[model samples]
Target: MGDELIEKAQELKTMIQNSAEYQKYDSCRHILKEDEELYRKVNEFRKKNFEFQTEGSAENGQADRLAEAYADVLGQKAVMEYMNAELILCRKLQEIYGLLVGDLEFDLDFLQ
Candidate 1:
């Protein structure tokens, strides 16, 4: 059963890889990987953006500042294209997960 599951998972992975969204994301990722400086900048921007999201404040509108900074980072062509493609792929994966989780209908109200 485990072997069969593994085979099915591999096939699913191959299908995803062949998808147009994944192909575009993979191509942009490869381009990003080739540019060390741009890649580092993009990562740094993403890190800070995530930080603001996970630990934001309403005192001085820190989220607003972070959003502006993120826009600036995204102004870079390579970063923008890669990020857009990456998000496309992520959303596609999320949709699949959502469908599976909805089908499972696990009762998690007690976990709260």
Candidate 2:
């Protein structure tokens, strides 16, 4: 049964990779990777965004700064397209996971 489950998980992974949302994300990511300057800009933006998130309320105006930086990155066509495609892919994965969890009908309150 354990081996069967692993096989099924592999199949699910393949399905996700073949999904249109993932395909778009993969293509956009490849384009971003091919451009040295764009990749650096995106990576910098991501690092700053992550810092802002982790800081939470620890730093005033950090989020605003991050937002302004993000807006500037959005002004670049490649960055905007890649970011949008990545969002779509992430949402698609979230939907799939949520559907599976709903079907399982686990009682989470019991854990508490």
Candidate 3:
């Protein structure tokens, strides 16, 4: 059901937000260590869901059109959230890398 899917999506969002890995990215070092795994899981889930949707039928025949629609919406939201987090991590990395490489451009812009 749509309601159940939405609830599950919300629960997943809460879990992601409250995860230790998500909270540990206060510095570039942490981000660098954790971002890859986080992004990989997100991307893998997105790909798997997309592939499942494309398959057009469920083994148990329980996947109705409405259920598919609900799942698609949930998947899209999850992907978007993952992308937003990835972008934030990338920007943090760029700032740190620039500082390390003596590229003052990011420092000037970021510090402002």
Candidate whose TM-score is highest: 1
Write candidate 2's Cα lDDT for 1-112 as tens digits.
9999899889999999998999989998898889897798888887877776786842788767667867866677778889999889989889988887767866689778
State the lDDT of candidate 3 residue by residue for 1-112, as single tens digits: 9999899778866765665545543333344336576546555555665666688545555345444554544355444555556557557656645665674444466666
The positional error of residue 12 in candidate 3, measured at the CA in angstroms, is: 29
Candidate 1 regions with alpha-carbon error over 4 angstroms: 56-60, 70-72
User: Which lDDT value does model 3 have at 3?
Assistant: 100
Of candidate 3, the 10-residue stretch with the lowest lDDT total is: 24-33
Model 3, CA-based lDDT = 0.55
Ranking by TM-score: 1, 2, 3
Q: List the residue pairs that clash in candidate 3.
A: none
lDDT of 2 at 34: 92
RMSD over all Cα atoms, model 3: 19.2
lDDT of 3 at 41: 59
List clashing residue pairs in candidate 1.
none
RMSD of each: 2.4, 3.0, 19.2
Which stretches in model 3 have alpha-carbon errors above 4 Å?
1-75, 103-112
